[model samples]
Target: MSLPDFSGTTPQERLASLRRSVAGRIVFTTSFGLEDQAITHMIREGGHDIEIVTLDTGRLYSETHAVWAETEQRYGLRIRSFHPDPQALAALLDDWGANGFYHTKDARLACCGVRKVEPLKRALAGAEAWVTGLRADQSQARGDVMAIEFDTGRGLAKAAPLHDWSREDVARFCETNGVPVNALHAQGYPSIGCEPCTRAVKPGEPERAGRWWWEQDDAKECGLHVDADGKFVRAKEAVQ
Candidate 1:
């Protein structure tokens, strides 16, 4: 499917055009964060036909759940949820304790694979295009992200409506439009993922510093996004 040239259009215009072009083949994944909330508002309030989904890692914060419910109520939309395969999750837990991810990078990635990446693959299976709330300023890994690009990892066209929006811009939009957002964001958690792996960022730290704080490396992504090498690599043996 050929996408319309979104070069000179606003984000809302681009999103509307993408929805019309892709129709039912488009899906949006949200983590209920501030940015995602803004995009959700745009999609829902704009009456776009795009389907919205989320990963339920079972390790999410209560605040995240609260926002999810609130979003549904506010927009009167049902956000589909995807979860890890039970057998795989049980096998992973049996091999490594519940918190095994704290031990090594491989273990952490394995957990992420079962709880996030794998489920995401299923969620995106029939999608021709997927939408994200990613912004270039969020992390070094995403510094080069464009508004629209083909996601080689998922083999689909990925759209980031908020790609150029700033943190302050997102905050102002949410406040001005009354968008539902995670409560954790107010308590210093600029980025919220699974509850155990994420924490609040300290002063002088990057917004994404709160996610996977133990890792000394700067590649803090959970394999949902492409890596610096432009590969969708994840922990070995995660699929089996």
Candidate 2:
């Protein structure tokens, strides 16, 4: 991959350029979270030709699944669904016995690797660039999320248009545009992920407090975005 000179520009401008370059081959991955919803609206409004996809981690909330159906009907775009390898899942289950994630951090990460990361790797295999709803305000690790990035960590070119958007900005966009959202957000589930691993956050809490609440401070991410050495850096390294 040639590292082209991308003068640091605003997210909107970067998105416009990406659209012009990739045309209809770009893909967006959404989980129907607030940030994801905002991204979907922006790409649509900007008139970018990109396909949207999502991974049904097999343990997602019912509300998330329901919104998927509603979103497709509302947007009139098909969101291709990706699933984990059934044989791989069966093997993991047999070795770890299910619910092993609750036992240790390593165990939990292993489950997430099989359920989310592996499936995502397959989903992005043929794509030139992928868009995500990740926001810089969501976590310190993501504080440097740029509009365009080479995701050497995941072996894909990644673009995060809403990386600089705040939580309030995302909410306003969804409210103003009538974008369908997960019902649990209104119930105080600010950060939504797998059902078992996520819970409703208390009032006046950090947005991501609900995700991996049982783990220590720095162990929030699910290994899907981490480097080979188990470090979570802000920018993606060179994809040799």
Candidate 3:
């Protein structure tokens, strides 16, 4: 696939350029974080055809839901939500109690897989490109983010337009564009995920220090960005 032009005078221009250049359908998954909110603004203002969706892990914070409602109200755009299959959710609950994930890393990953990864697969179905708000500074596990890459396992092009932008840059963009964002970020939760698996980090902590924080430092990520072949974008050397 030919690489789309990811450069522009502004983030909105870059995203609009992507929409024009990329072939087939494009899906943008937002977690209602600052970075995602910035991208949502670009998509809405530019009136791009990208489908905006989110994975409802069912354990998200109430503030997250509030922001989601606000965004839809502001944009008049219905952000599609992908939920875990009821049967699959039930089976997971039956096997592991609601909070079982806290006890072991395996359990946590299992929960993430059932709640996030599966739903994400459904969300990406029939999509030619998958766009995310991933930034290089979010965490060491994601520190090597690229603007474009071929997700071989999913047979789709993945683009992270804001990969080079810092967290402060995203926040400034949101403020300048009036994009709705989750309120949890102000409470020291720079990287917000499921309520059960997330917390507010202490001073000087990395953005993602709160996500799955109990596990070993290297044991980051919830399998959402992990490929089916056990390879991760951050861990592998850049292909291009």
Clash tally, candidates in order: 0, 0, 0
> Which residue pairs collide in model 3, if any?
none
lDDT of 2 by residue, 177-215 (tens): 999999999998998889989999888778888998888
lDDT (CA) per prediction: 0.84, 0.78, 0.84
TM-score of 1: 0.92
**Runs of candidate 1 exceeding 4 Å displacement:** 1-4, 227-240
Residue pairs with colliding backbones in model 1 are none
**Candidate 1 local lDDT, 1-240, one digit each (tens):** 454344424567778877776745888999999999999998877788888999999999999999999999999988999999999999989988899999998889889989998999999998898889988899887777677777656667788788788999999999999998898988999999999999999999999998889999886788888654635333221100
Q: All candidates' TM-scores?
A: 0.92, 0.90, 0.93
RMSD of each: 5.2, 2.9, 2.1
* Residue 126 displacement in candidate 2 (angstroms): 1.7
> How high is the lDDT of residue 100 in model 1?
98
The segments of candidate 2 whose C-alpha lies over 4 angstroms from its true place after superposition are 3-13, 236-240
